[model samples]
Target chain A: MHLLPKKKKKPSREPYREISPGSKPVKWIYLSIMLWFMGRAIQAAARVDKTVKAEFDALPEGFAFSLGVFPDGPYMVLGKNIHGQVKSLGRRGQEQALDVRITIKNIEAAILLFTFQESTAISTSRDRLIVDGDLSQACAVIRILDIVEVYLLPKIIARLAVKRYPTWPMTQKMIGRIRIYFRAVLGY
Target chain B: MDTKEINIIQHRQPGIVESLPYNYEFYNPVKICSGKKAMAHIPFELAAINAVRPLVLASDSPIGRRAIKLLTNAFKESEMSFYVCDDVPDNADAETVRRLTTLYLEKNHDAIIVAGDGAAVDIAKVIRLMVAEKTDDLEQFEGEIKLSHAPAPLITLQTFDGSGLEASGWATVCNQTFFSAQLAPQICIIDPRMIIPMDIKTTWARAMVSLTQAVEVYMAADRNPVAINYASTAIQSIRKNLAPVFSNWVSNKKRLALINAYTAAACAFSNNQPGPGFLLGKAMAQMGNLNLGTAMGIILPYVMTQYMRKTNCDLADLLRPLSSDDDYAGTTSSLRGKKAIRCLYDLQWTWHQAGRRKIPLTLKDAAVGRYLFPDIIETALKNGLPVFDETDCETVLEHAWEAKPLNVTS
Candidate 1:
C-alpha cells in the first residue's frame, strides 16, 4: 500500500519572459559627465590652443555637429557661432539644428572609445561609429575629436587614442593640457 | 589524369567561381572556418574583403543573445566595433527589414554579419540582396531566383537549429523563395559556442533535412564525383554524431560534427537541382505548416524507396555511410538497398519513440490529410524539380502518409 503511486503534483507554470534591451546605466552616467567636461574643454581649447584655433578658422562659419550615442544621448554639440568662437552646447535639444552628426552605435562601443580602450581611428575603421552629414565637415569634426582626446588623456593613453601622435614640445604639451583643464573646470 | 583531359578553371578575381560541363565541374567558393576559436577569425575575413563596417543582425531569443555575447567576446582583444541589432523579429516583418535598411545605409555598413538562424539569416541575405542589387521591391523577384553580381560579404553564425540552408544560395524571406549561388555566404563560421542544445523534435527536423540534401547529391541523376565526395563525408559524419546527440549523451564536439555536416551538405546540394525528397519536403512543410526538417524526415524513407524504384541505380552505396563496418559487410549486396531503407525506418522509429510520439512518422501522424496533398504537388511543380512530376509527388506523399515503404521492385 505504501509503494503505491502518490498524488501527482501540479507543475508550476513560468510567466512570460522577454528580452530587455541591455543598457549600462553607470556607463551612461559616466559618458554624460565626460561629454560635459569635454564640451567645455573643447570650447576652452579652441580659444587657447593655436592648432585648434587654426582648424576652426578653416571651418565654414556656423558649422555645428553633435557626437553621442543613438536613441538616447548625452552629447556635446560644438559649433562655430557668428561671434567667431567655438561654444560647447551641452546636449543639443531636437529643436537645435545640426550640420553634422557623429554617432557611436551603442554604450559598449562608446565606453571603449571614452575609456581609451580603442582609438577613434580604430573605432571608425572598425565601424563602431557612424557619421551622418557632409563628408568633409565630418572629417573636420573627427580631427577635432582627435585633438581633444590628446589633451584629455595622458601621453601613453593619448598616443593609443590618436592615429598619429603630434610631436609637440614638452612645455607646449604640458602648458596646453594645464590650460585646457583649467578652463574646462573654471566654466570658461 | 592527363593535363589536357582536365582543364581546371580558377576564378581570376575573388567572389566568382565558374562551373564548366566538361570533366568534374566541382565548385564551392565558401571559405569555411570551423573548430575552436573559429569566431575569432571573422575579423581577418572582414579584413580580406576590405570591409571595416559590418552590421550584425541577430534573433532576440536567449540563445541568440548568448551567441552575440560569444561573438562580442571574440572581438574583445581586437579594435573592431561592429554594430549589432539583436532585436530582429522571428517572422521577419517588412518594417524591421526596412528600418534595418535605413540604419545600414545611414551608417554606411560595408558588410553583413548574421548571427542566429532562420529569420535572422533570411533577413540578412535579403538585406544584402536589396542593398547590393538596389532592388527596392523584393516582391517583383518572387518565385524566381535572380542575381547579376555577388552580394556584399556575408558571414553567418548559426546554432544547430536551422533549415540547414542558411549558408546556401537559398533564402525564404517573407514566404518568398530566392536562390542564386552568389547569395551564399562568403565566410561560414562554425563555432561550437554557437551550438544550442535542443529537444529531439528540433534535432530530428534539422538532421532529416541534412540527410535529404546529402542523399540527393549522392544519388543524383547526373553524378559528379567531387560533389559525391562532399555528400558522402556529411552522411558518415551524421551517422557517427546523430545517435550520441539524440540519446541525451550530447557534447560540444558532436554538435560541431552535425553543423559541419550541414555545411558540407549545403556545398554539395547548392550546385545540383533539389531531389524529389528535398523538393517534397519543402512542399510538405508549406502545405502542413510543419517544420521543414520534420516534414523531410517523415518523407525520407518512403521517398528513398520510391527514388530507388525510379532511379534503379545501385542504392547499396547509401548503406556504407549509414551503417557501421561489420553490419554493412554482413548485409549481402542484393539486400543492401533494402537494408538501407530498413535502417532509415529504424531511425525514424527511434525518433518517434524518443519524442514520446510527439515526432510524427507519417503525414497523417502530422495531422496533414490527403485534401492538402494537391498543394504539395503544385509547390513541387513551382520549384520545377527536373526528375519529378505531379504524379510522382502524389505517389511519394501517399506512401509517406501511410508510414509504408513503396513495394514496387525495379
Candidate 2:
C-alpha cells in the first residue's frame, strides 16, 4: 500500500487584530469624570475641613501642583487661589509652571489612592508617587490631601488612609461629614 | 521596633520642616582625576598638591603588580621620582601601618600614592596619619580623633572601585576603624585600565560594597539632602552601569561610570554615620571569613525590609533613580519599597548568573550556617545603629540567614 503520503497542509494565517484607535475618546471621557470627582472632593474638603483649608492657605499665591498618571493619564492641578482656597484648575499640561507636582506612577496607583484602597504614606512608601520641586511644599500638599480624605471618607477608611487621624470632636466630625457629602454631591 | 513605633518615629517629618532642628556638618575635599587614562594625570595632580617625591603603596597581588608597571611606565619619561612598596598586606594591621610610616619617613617621600584595593588604601591612610601626627601609637588616633594638621599629600589610585576608601575620611586598621577628615585622599585617580584586568567577581564584589555603603547612607538617621542626592545618583549609576561592565569589561565608559558611582557613594558615606546594615555586615564578614561586600550583599535587602517593617518612612523614593519611568509608573506606591528590595535581589541573581563565580544570594548559599546566628546577632547588637536594639538585630540576622526570596505576605 504505497500510497502517496498526504501533503502537509500549510497553516492558515490569522488576520492581525488591530486595536481600535477609538480608545482615545473613551480615555478622555474617563479622565473628565476623574477630574470632576477630584474637583468636587477638593471643594467639599475646603468647605468642611478647617485643616485642609489651613494647609491651602499656608501655600504661596499662584502655587500650583498637578496630580496624575504619566504620559496619557488624566491630570488635575490644584492651585492656591488669591482668596486662599484650593481650586482644581481642570485638566491642564505643564503650562501652569506648578510649584510642586505630584505624579502617581501609574493609573493603577491612582485608582488605589482615589478609591482609598491605599493611604498616601503607603503609596509613598511603595514608590508610587513622584514629587517634583520643593519637597516641603509637597509635604504640605500631602497634609492637605490627608485632611481631605478624613472629611470625604468614613472614619474607618480615613483612619487607614492617613498616617495619623486627628481626634476631632463628635459634633465637628458629624458636621464636617454632612457638609462634605452635601457639597460633594452638589459639586460645590 | 514594631511597625507602630516605626510609624510614629517617621511621623516626625524632618523633610517638611523649613529647617530641621537637627544639625549636621559635611566636608569632602578630594580632587578627582577620572575618565580615559586618568592615571596619566597623576604626576600633574602630584605637582598640583605640591609634592615632588611620592611613595606608591600596593599589595603583592596582580593588581599591585600592574599598578606598579603602569605608574613606572607613566613616569618613565618624566623626571618625577616615585618609590614602590608592594608589600602591604591584605589585613592592614597596626604593624603594617607603622612599617609603612617608617618607610615613608626613611625614604623622605613627600607624598603617597595608595594604588590597590581597600586594604592597601587603608594602610596608606594610616601611614599618612602616622607620618603627619608623628606617632606610631594607633591608640591616639582611635575612634573619631581630629587631626590638627593635614597629612602629607595623598593621591589614591584605586585599582578596584568599591571601598570608597579613595575618598573616604575613615580607614580600617586591624579590628578598629578610625575616622578623620585628614584621612581623605588629596587626589583620587580612577583609570579604567587598572579595573579591566581584575577578575569579574572581585570587580562585582567591590561595586556591591560601594552600593551597600550608598544604600546605608540613604537609610541612615543622619541623612541630609546633599547626602541623599549623592547616594541616589551613585545608586542610579551603579544600576545603569553594573551589568554592562560585567558583560563587557573592555568598555572604558562603563568602568568610568562605576568609578564615578564609587566616588559619589564614598563622598556621601563620608558625610554620614554608618547605618546598621554596614555595622552588621562588617561584623558578619569578620565572623564568617567572608568578604565584607559578600556579607553586605546578602544582608542589605533584609535590613531594608526590616527598616520598612518598623518605620512608616517611604523607602520607595529610592526606586525613582534605580527604575525606569515606565516601571516606576506601573508600580503602585504601597508596593514600591518592596519592589526596590526585590529589584536588588533580582540584580544579585543576574550578577550570579552572569559571573563565573556566582555571588551568593543567601547566607546558606555562601555556606554561612544558621548556627552562627547567636554570634552574628551579638556582634550586630554591639555594632549596629542605636536605633536598632538587640531584638531588631536578631530579626534581621535571622531573615538574612534564611536568604529566601522575599514575599509580600511576610
Candidate 3:
C-alpha cells in the first residue's frame, strides 16, 4: 500500500538532427560548437593583462577608457596632436586640444595601450603575436602596449618597436589613449 | 502573412533564455565592412611593426591559402612575420580547436582572422569562443549571447556568400543545433572577388536564401521599422542585381551588389528576429533533409503573395518603396501591395528570361511528392514554431505547389 504507483513514462527527447546508425551530424555539430568556444577563449586570454585591469579599476569617476592590447611588447594606443596639445577625448567627447604638448601626447598614447588589453584584436602566432589592422587600429593597439610598459611594469628589457612617442602629458591623457585603443580592438 | 506586431524577444525566448530578453541596443558602425586588397596586406605589417603577433586562421583550401600568401607577400617586403593556421580541419573537432588555441598562445599570436565560407569561418569563431569563455563543449553556451572574456581582433572574410553567418551571431553547424553570439565574428570583410569564383548553382541557392532572409526580416512580427527599411533596400538591391546574373555570371560589380544585398538581408533578418518565412524554411530543411536555401527559394514567392493577401495595408507600405517605376507617392494599400507583387512577378520573369533559373515549381522537382506534405506539416508543428495551424500551413504549401505569381490588381 505504501509503494507508490509507477511514475508516468517520460517522452523521449527527439534528437535535433536525425541520427542514423552511422550518422555523425551530432558529433560534427558538437565539434563545431566546441571549436567556436575555443577560438573565443584564446582571443580573451591573449588580451588580458595585469596592468590593463588595474588601470581600468583605478579610473576616476566620470573617467572612462578604450584600449586594444597585443599579446606581447609595449602596449600602445592612438592620440592626435590638435593645434599644439594632444587631446584625450575620443569620438564621443569634444574637449579638443587647442595647444600641443609632448607630455599630453604621450599620456594620450599610454591610454591607448591600456584600452587595447580589452580589445578583440589580439591574436597569437607560432613564434610571434600579431595584432592585425589599419594605421588607426594599430595605433590604438600600440597605445595599450605602452601603458603596460611604462605604468604597470617598472623596467622592461624587451619592447615591441612601435612608433617612438614622447611621454610627458598627464596620466589621464595616457589612460584616454588606451581606452580608445581598447574600443578599436573590441570593435565597439 | 496576417501580421500582428510581434515581439521578437518573445519568439525565440523559451528555447534560448530565461530573462525574456535583455535590452539589445544594436548599431552597425559601418553598414558594410569593405576590405580592399590593401587592407588585407596592411594589418600584418602594422601588427608586426608593433610586435603584435595575431593568429591567422584560414580555410584549408587553395583559395584560402592564396589569400594568406597574398598577405605574407605584401608584408614580406615590409619585414612582417606571420604564422598561418591553414591546417585547421574542415570539420575541426573540439580537441583540435583547443590544441590550436594552445598553440596560438604558446606561439604568442595576438588575434585571429578567419577566411573562407561558413564552415571555415565558423570554425575560427568557435576557436575564439573556446579561448575567451574557457569551454570545450560548445553546447553549454547554446541559445545565449553568453560571453565572459573579450575575444581577440577577429575578422571573418567570406570566400563564398549566402550562409548568413557573417552578420548573424547564430551559426548552424548542422540542422537543429546552433552556436550563439559568443561565436559572433567581431568584424566581417566582404570582397566581391571571393564570391565570383563560386559555381552558379551555389550562387543561385545563396541568392534565393538572401531573398527569403530579407522578406522574413521585413515581415517579422517583431519587425523593427529600422530593420524593415534596411530589408526593403536590401531586397530591391538583390532583385535588381540577381536578375542579370543568370545570363552573365561574370559581372564583378553586379556580383558585389548581390553579395552586399545578402549581407544586408542577413544583418536585418537576424537583428530584427526571423519571421514566418525563415521558420518555415528551417522546419522544412531540417525535416526533409533538403537544402535550406533551395527550400526558401521554392516557398518565398508564394509566401510573399499570401502575406500581401493577409496584411494588405502593411504590405502596401512595403511595396510603395519598390515601385520606382510607378507613381507611389500616395498610393492606396491595395494598389501598393499589387504593385509590390507585380514587381516580384517581374523578378521571376527576369529570372526566366535570363535562363529559367528558379526554384522548382513543384515538390516533384524537389524529389518529394504530395505524400510528403503531412510530414512537412508534422515537422513544422513539432518544432514549436508559431504558425496559425495546419490549415495555414496547407494554404502556404498549396501556393508553393502551384508556383504561380499572384494577380496583382493594379
Candidate 4:
C-alpha cells in the first residue's frame, strides 16, 4: 500500500482570509460565508473534544454561529451584539439583532453535503462540501482560527460569485480534492 | 536464434477449498506430502519448465512462510525469477482467483512452487483448469477423465493428507458447495518435514481415508494386482506406522510410519477408480461432518470384514506386510481379518485414553438416534457402490448400529 508524507506545521499567523462587511444587504452575504466555512470546519473536526463556550466567545462580534453535535454534547452559545450597524443601499439602516443557539453532540463520522442556489443577483450557486478525518484536530484548529477558509469555498462561492464562471465541474473537482484530503488526514 | 514463446499467469493458492474448470489439463507428479508444511518433489515437467522459465514460491502458513523465504533465497542464489501469491485469504473466492490470474498474465510468471496442504495445491490446480477450460465450475467436470493436454507446469508441495488428488487427475473441495476434480497438478513435491506438524486426530483421519481407499480397491470387482499392492502397502502402513505415531508424536519411527501410510494411500488412488472404503469415507465425511480419515479408519475394518465373510480366507494375503510382526505373525487368515476389527476398537480406545473425545462407534451414535441407514444407502446406490445391495446394506447397517465386532466364520 502507498502512503503520503505528512505536512510540516507553519508558524502561527492571523486569519488568512475574511469576508468584509458592506451594506445591509451585503451583511447577509458575509454572514453566510462565515456560517458555511465554520460549518464545514466543525463537521470536519467532528471528533475533536473542545469547550463549546470558548468556541462561541472566540467568534467575531456582530456574527453569531451555533455548533451542533448530533446526539448529546455541550454547545457554545453566542449572543447577538446590538452595537454593529448595516447600511442599506447607500444609507445606514436600523441594526437587526440576531440570536444564535447551537446544540453539539459527539457524532464523529464523515458527512458529505452538496447544495446549489440560484438568485437573480448571482449567476450560479452550486456548492459541495466534504468533512472527514480526525474530528479532534479540526476542532482545535477551529478554536484557534475563529474562521476556516473552507477550501471548498471556491465551488460554493463560484456559483454565487462571478456570473460567467463555471461551477458544475469545479464543484466536482473540489469534492474530489476534499475526498483526497480526508483520505490523507484519516490515513485511509 | 529461435527463442521459445512464453506465457505467464498468476494463480491463487487458497488455504481453505476450491474447485477447478472442466476443459483444463492437469498433471500430478505422483509424490505429495501431507501435514502442516508439506513439500512435493518437483516434477520432471516443472524441471523442464525451470530450465527455460522462472518458478515462484507461494504459501501463507507459518511453515509455508519459512519455506517461501528459504525457497526465495535458494532461487535468488540459483538466479531464478519468482513471485509469491500470499496476499489472498486462505479460502479464496472466484473473484480472488481471477485477480491472481490477471497478475500472472501481467508478470508472465512461467509456473509456481505450491506449498501448503490440499487447499493450496487444489487452488493452484483450479487456476490451471480455469485458464484451460475458460470456466470455473468444477462440478461440471467431476468424475474420471483423461487430461492429455498439459497445463502450465505447477509443482505442488503437500503438507496435509489425501491420496485421491495425488493419484488421479482430480481435486475435490467444499466452497459452501461440493466440487470435484477435473484436472490434476502438473508436478508434486513430497517431503516428510511438512507432515510432522499434523495433529494426531487429523493424521489418523487422513490415514483412514487413504487406508480405506486402498482396501476398497483391493475388494473392488475390478481389483487388479497393481491396486492390491498399493492397498496392501497402505493398510500395513496404517497398522504399523499410524498406530505407533498415534501413540507417540515425538518418535521419528512413528513419523516415518505415518508418511509411509500417506504415500501408500496416494499411490492407491493415483488411478481414477475408488473402492468401498473410499466411497464410505467420502460419504461419512460429507454427510456426518466426520473427518475423512477417522471415518475411513472407523469403517475400513468393517468393510473389509464384510468382504472377507463372503469371500475366501486366502484373501488375507493382502495384509502380509502387517502380518509379519511377531504380535501377528502366526495369526490365521480368518483371525487376521478379526484383527482388523480389533484394531479399529483399539483406535477408539486410544482416542479416549489420549483425552480426545471418542467418536460415536456406529451410525446410531454418529446421528444421535437419527436413522441414517436409509439415507446413506440411498446415496450409495446412486453413486454406484456395488458392495451391498438393499438387503445386504440393511444387514450391514443393523450390524453397524449395534457396533458388533466381526470375527472369523467356519
Candidate 5:
C-alpha cells in the first residue's frame, strides 16, 4: 500500500531572464554617451579649473573617490588627489578605499543632472544622489564641481546649475573658457 | 540683481526654500497609551493586537528592574501571561539578538514587550525582526529592506524619555541601522513614574534630544504640513517643560507634557529621516563616547544656523512657542527669526549656568580634541545628511568646538 503511492517529481526552478531583448543595446548606447561626456567634463575641470585644483589640494593626502550610477555603473569618474592633480583612475577606482563616493540613483537622474535639466541641489533634495564616505569631503567636492560648471557652461546655464554664482572678471572668464575647451578637445 | 529677482531666486531653489510640487510619502502606525498609570493598559493593548504570551525584555539597571516589577505586578492581577528576561545588557549586539530570538521561538511567544529605555527597545525590535524573518543573519535586513510579513506585535514601555525609538521605524542593531514600517511599536506606554529615578542631567539631555528632533523636523527639506504641525506642538511642549523637569520639581503635569512632546517629535521624526544636527550629534557621540542627548544639545543651535542659511526660511514662527508672547509680538517679522535664534543661544547659556557647569557647553569642554574631527565627520556622513559635504561638517564642527552662542547677525 505504501509503495503504491509515489510522489510526483517537482519542477526545477528557472533562472530569471530579461523579457525585452531590444532594451539591452539601447541601455548600453545611453551609458556609453553618458560616460564619454562625463570623461570630457572631468578632463576639462582638471586641466583649467583653479577651484577644482584648490579643493583637491585641501583634501587629506591619498584621498580618493568614485562618482557613478548604481548597480550597472560605468563609474564615470574615479579620482585621487595626487599632488593636487585630481587625476582619474578610470575603471580601477572601484577597488580603492575611497574617501568619498557619490552614486546617482539611476541613468535617468544622471542624464537630468548632466544635461542641465536639474541642478545638483535639486537632484540631492529629490533624493537622487546616494553619497558614501566623508560628508565634509563630499561638500568640498560639490563646491569644486559648481566652480567647474561656471567655467564649462555658459552664464545662463551656469546660473541654473548653481545656487549662487560667484562673480568673476570678464577677462578671467574668457580665458578659463578658452583653456577648458582647448584642453578638453586635445586631451591635455 | 534687484530685490524682486533675489526673492524669486530664493523661492525657486529646492532645499533653500520649502517649495510646492515636492513629492514625499509618510506612514506611522503606532497606538500610544499615556497618562498617570498608562502601564495599566498593557493587558488591553496586548489583547487588541491578539498577543497572549509576550516575551518581556528589561535591562539590569535600577530603572529596568523597577519597570519589570511594575509590569509583573500589573500582570499578576490579569489573565495575560508574560515571561520576563531582565538580563538585557547595554548596547546589545547581534549575538544577544540571536539568543533572544531563539528564546522567543522556543517559548512560543506571540508578542515582545520592551520595558526600559532606547537600548532595550532597540534590542527587542531586532529580536522581533529575526523571529519574523525566521533567520539569525540580521545583515540581510539592513538598510531599508522591506519585510514581507508584519513583525511580532511589539509593546514598548519607556523607563525614560530620551530615545525616540518608541514611535520610530528605524533601529540600530549593532553598528548597522535597519528600517521597516512594521518595526514601529504596535503600542507605546509612557508614564512619568518610570523615569523618577533617572538623574536630572540625563532627563535634561533626553528632553534636549526630543527638542532637537522637533526643530529639525520643522527645518527639514522634505517636511510636509502634517509633520510641521506635530513639530510645532512638540517645540511648544519642550519649551514649557524642559527646565521644570530638569529642576526636579516633579509636577506630573509638566512630566506628562514632556512625554507628549517626545511622542509628537518621534511621530514627526518617524515620517522623515534624521537631519544634519542628528547625524552630526550621533557621529560626535560615537567618536567622543558622549551621551547622544548631550551631543545633540551642544550641536543643535549650530546645525539650525546652517539650515537657516541654506533655506532662508523664516524662523520667527518658532518664537511664539519657544519664547514669551511679548517677545513674539514686539519683534518685527524680519527681526523675529534673529530673536528666536538668540533665544536658543540664551536658553543654552541658562541651562549651562543652572547645571553649574556640570554639563560641557563646548566640544573643547567635553575634552573632545580637534584630532577626532575628521573621524566624526566621516561617521556623520555615513549616518545620514547626504546634502552636507566635508566643508559644511568642518564649519559646523569648528563652530561647535568653540561652543559660542550662534552669531545671529550676518
Candidate 6:
C-alpha cells in the first residue's frame, strides 16, 4: 500500500564489552600470610596434638592436599611422609600429584573462612569451596583444619569456627595450645 | 444423583483418606542459595560439579539485562568463565533451541547458567538435554523420568518471576513435556539484587499459586513429613508476607521471603502430582487467554472447598499456616478445615482490594463464561493426574462461577 519504494536502513550495532574477572590483591596477600601460618601450624599440630596425629595416621601415607584459592593461590599443601610424619609442603603441593584439592572459590570466601566469619562446615554447606579429589580425604583434611583452628584461635573464636568444641582438660588444652603455638611460630 | 454416581464418589473418597502418608517419598536436588552474596557462590557450585565454562542464557529485556550484569559482577574474582547469550527470544521456539544448541556445541560450553524466567530457562534446559543425550530427537525425550544419566551441572538464577517449573524437574520445550529430577538445577541462586518490581497482577498471581500449591501438596494423600515441612514453610511465609509484599513500598526482604516460599512450594509440588487446581489452571492457560497464576488464583478456594466436602482430605493442618498458631490451636479440629478454607477467602479478597478490585473474584468476573467450563475440564482431564473426575471438575466450576467457595456447606 505504500506509494513510494520502501527504504531499509541497517540496524546499528553496539560493540561488545568484555567482563574481565577482578582480583583482590589485599585479600590475597592477607590470605597468603595466614595460609603460611596455618600450613606450618598443621605440621606442628600433627607432632604435638595427638588428635591431629591420629587423624594423619588414619590417612594413607603420602596423602597430600592443596587448600586455598584457585588459579593464583594463598595455598597450603600438606602431605604425610613415609616415616609416619605430616609435613607442610608450602605451595609446592600443586606441582605434586595431590590426593585432594580443596579450593576456596575466591579470596573473599577464603577471607570468610580464615577470618572466623564462617565455620568450615558452614562454608562447605554454603558452597564457598570446591573439593576436587577423594571426598573421604577432603573430609579428613577439613577435620584437621578444625583441630588446628582450635589451637590457633581463642576458645570463643575457635568454638565459632569448629562444629563442636572438644572437652579437653584445662591443662591439656593450655599445654597443647602453648606447644603448638611455639612450634608453629618458631618452626622447631 | 444415580446410585452408580454416588458409589463412584464414595469409593474415591475413602481411597484418598486411607492413603499411607507414612510410606511415601520426598526428594529435591536443587540447593537454594539466597542472600546478598548468593550470586558469588555460583562459581563454587559450578566447580563442585566440574563445570568450568557455562553457557549463560538470559532474557534480553531491561530487567533481564540488569540481572545479567549483577550476575556477571559475582564472577569477577572467581576465576570461572562463561558466555552470555542474553538474546533469548520470547517464544523460545524449537528454531531458537536448535540454534542455541548448535552455538553451545560450537562454543564448547560445559554447563548452563539460566538467568531469567521460563523461556530462557526452558531453552537452556532443552539445550542441555539435546547436548546430554547427543541427539536431535526431542519428541522421544518426552514423558516422566526419561533421563538415564545426569546432564552437566545447571544453575538457575531466579529474577522474581518464572513459570513455576524453572526450579522443578520439569520442562515444556515446544509443547513436549520432559520430566526428570536430573533436569532440575543443581543450585538455585536468589539474590536480592535480582528482585525487580513487576506488575501487581503478576506479583499476586505468583503469590496465589505458591499459596495454593503449598496447600495442595500439604493435603496430598501420599504427602510425606519432609514435603509437609517444605509446604508448611511456604504457606506460613506466604500468609505472613502477602500484605507487606503488596503494599506501595517495595521490600526486597519481604519479597525474598515470598520467593523462598515459591521455591519451597515448587519443591513440594515436584515431590507430588499436579493438584486439581494446578491442572485446571494449566488448561485455562493453554486456552491462550488466561495467565496460569491468575487462573490458579481464581479457582483455588473453590477447589479446596470441593476437596473438603467430597474427599476425606485432612485440611486441619492447613490452619496452622493459614492463620496464627493461636487461631489454629483455639479452633476445634472439626471446624479447623472450614476456618482454613475461610481464611483463603479472606486472603484472596486482600489481593482483590490491593489490585483495586481488578483481580477477578469469579469465573464471570474473569469474563470466562460457563460455555468455556467444559473445555477447561476436558483439557484438565488430559493432564491425567487422577486427582479430579468430571463431576468434581463440574462442581468446582459451578461454585467458582458463582464465587461460592463456602456457600454450599457450613
Give lDDT per model, in order.
Answer: 0.77, 0.72, 0.51, 0.47, 0.73, 0.79
Candidate 3 or 2, higher TM-score: 2
Q: Which candidate leads in lDDT?
A: 6
How well does each candidate superpose onto the true structure, as a TM-score? 0.63, 0.62, 0.59, 0.54, 0.63, 0.76
Model 6: reference contacts kept, as a fraction: 0.20
Q: What share of the true interface contacts does each candidate keep?
A: 0.00, 0.00, 0.00, 0.00, 0.00, 0.20
lDDT of 3 by residue, B1-410 (tens): 22332335323221123222344444443224443342333443335334456566766455565566554533332334556666666676666666777776677666666656666666666666667776666666554456778655566665544366566566644232444544565556566545534444455667778788877765665556566666777788876776566544357777777767777776666565555566677677766777777677777766666665555434554464455535454555346656666666666556645645444544456765666667888777766545336766677776676664444321
RMSD of 6: 8.2
Candidate 1 lDDT, B1-410, residue by residue in tens: 65543434221211012222255566677877776556766765686688977877877566566676777765543446678777788887667777777778888889988887767888888888888777667777765466766688899886788778876787887778787777788988888878767777788788889899998885676657677767878888887777667655657899899999999889888877788888888888888788888888888887778777776765676776777656677877778888888877887776577667768888888888899998888987887765667777788898888775676484
User: Which candidate ranks first by TM-score, i.e. highest?
Assistant: 6
Candidate with best DockQ? 6
Better-scoring candidate (TM-score), 2 or 5: 5
TM-score of 4: 0.54
Give one digit per residue, the lDDT tens place, for model 5 in B278-376: 888889889989888888888788877766765677666677667876777677768877777778888877777776666767888877889999999
Q: Which residue segments of model 1 deviate by more than 4 Å? A: A1-188, B1-24, B143-146, B247-249, B325-335, B353-357, B408-410
Among incorrect, acceptable, medium and high, the docking class of model 4 is incorrect
Clashing pairs in 6: none
Report the error of model 5 at residue B397, Å.
1.5
CAPRI classification of candidate 3: incorrect
**Candidate 6 error regions (>4 Å):** A1-26, A33-67, A77-88, A93-103, A114-188, B1-23, B137-145, B219-221, B248-251, B324-326, B351-359, B364-371, B389-391, B405-410
Where does the lowest 10-residue lDDT sum fall in candidate 3 chain B?
Answer: B12-21
Error of 5 at A70 (Å): 56
- Worst lDDT window (10 residues) for model 1 chain A? A12-21
Which regions of candidate 3 are displaced past 4 Å? A1-188, B1-24, B29-31, B35-38, B41-51, B74-80, B89-108, B174-176, B179-182, B308-313, B325-327, B356-359, B404-410
The window of 10 residues in a row where model 6 chain A has the poorest summed lDDT is: A1-10
Candidate 6, residue B84: Cα displacement in angstroms equals 2.1
Per-residue alpha-carbon lDDT of candidate 2 for residues A1-188, written as tens digits (9 for 90 to 100): 11123355445332111111122344345655765676678777876777777777777887888877544457777786788766777777456688887876444456566667778998887656778899999998888777777776788888888999989898887888788778878877
Quote the lDDT for B375 in model 3: 81
- Candidate 1 CAPRI grade: incorrect
lDDT of 6 by residue, B141-171 (tens): 7678566556877888876678777777778
